[model samples]
Target: MMSINFEQLKERSLVIRKRYHELERIHHESEWTVEEDALAFLTDAGLVGRHVMSQQGRWPKENTEEELKHKIGESIWWLTILAERMDINIGEATESFLTKTEKLFEK
Candidate 1:
């Protein structure tokens, strides 16, 4: 895989999302609503939590490390899509969050 910066990743994600939307329209005669996208994100986020529980031996079924890793990445992809749909800049939001959290822990 090629190395990509955040901007490039966001662009690629948008392209992929557009293609998915097109496919959805062709198959179902409508693309997913923003609320549907958000629900999808939530579903994936829940899977991430389940994987973490598996890692900690708290889940009934064991999950592989690779499964957990991929789920985490997928959750991030969902977040980027959600931010784009909501007209938010995910990069800026993440930066602001990190900066604010760091300031709170400063000596």
Candidate 2:
């Protein structure tokens, strides 16, 4: 069985958040509102990123680094919210994931 490090998971999450902040620094003009804004933001990012992927062209819309950073942080926010909503901890989630993965590996 492979070992999962809880600290490493948290660190990766923080790294992603840090990158998001870096992006925000580069794209600071953007003003964002949350929740309803998340869907629109993802749609725009996906669309632009997809266009860039498909046609090798730039997106017409401008998304700031801060907005990008917020998106990444938002994921962590959602995850934390889920943990709180379900009354679970990061450790519990880690254990559950480990158990499920191990069960699959045993098959």
Candidate 3:
């Protein structure tokens, strides 16, 4: 099986944000309040969820694994963009969440 590294993926988020910022109609990080960016990120995440359901045949629209993969990647990009605008360290936040969840279920 191919191994995936979250740290490497996290680093690419910055590059994605930079490229996306260059696209027309995309807002600069400075132009948005964290709340606004957070909302936008949430919207993208919801679309990703819909795509996932569609891939499972639980939602409407003719979806394929490719579509699902694209949506997931797009959602991650939005997430990183929001994090950047908010001055957040995505890697640290991810680690914190993992640690918190692991401790929560510790017996």
Candidate 4:
């Protein structure tokens, strides 16, 4: 599979978020306009979803049998934005974390 640069991936994530927001509005749930508000909503929703999934041992009924592709896109968007805003490369962070964690477990 081909990998995408951060900029391209971020652009695609914005479109994905827009599509979901439209769908949510059609179903009478959306109440935000700016990306900032939407990003906050996504953050809350993600944490809530994680808790629910952990309790149920699986995804919600909406994505029980398949990947929540759009939600995944939303997560990627937020993570990328957060990393850029903080001036950190997430890949590098992950590498460093894994390296340190591995050393701790190397007994």
Give the per-residue lDDT digits (tens) of candidate 2, residues 1-107: 57546556555655664566577667884433344335554565564444444343344444344555555555555454334435567768868999999999898
Candidate 1: where are CA atoms >4 Å away?
A: 1-4
Q: Say which prediction, candidate 3 or candidate 4, comes out ahead on lDDT.
A: 3
**Where is model 3 poorest over a 10-residue stretch in terms of lDDT?**
24-33
Which stretch of 10 consecutive residues in model 1 shows the poorest summed lDDT?
1-10
Candidate 1, residue 11: Cα displacement in angstroms equals 1.0
* lDDT by residue (tens digit), candidate 1, 1-107: 67666687689889999999999999999999999998998998898899899899998776457898998888888889999989899889999999999999996
Q: For residues 1-107, what per-residue lDDT tens digits would candidate 3 score against the true structure? A: 57556556667776765565566235543545567667877887888888888888898779467877877877777776676667777778889999999999996
- Flag regions of model 2 displaced more than 4 Å: 1-59, 63-65, 102-107
Number of the top TM-score candidate: 1
TM-score of 1: 0.89
TM-score of 2: 0.35
lDDT of 4 by residue, 81-105 (tens): 5565566776677689899999999
lDDT of each: 0.89, 0.55, 0.72, 0.64
The ten-residue window of minimal lDDT in model 4 covers 60-69
Count backbone clashes in candidate 4.
Answer: 0
Evaluate model 4: give its lDDT.
Answer: 0.64
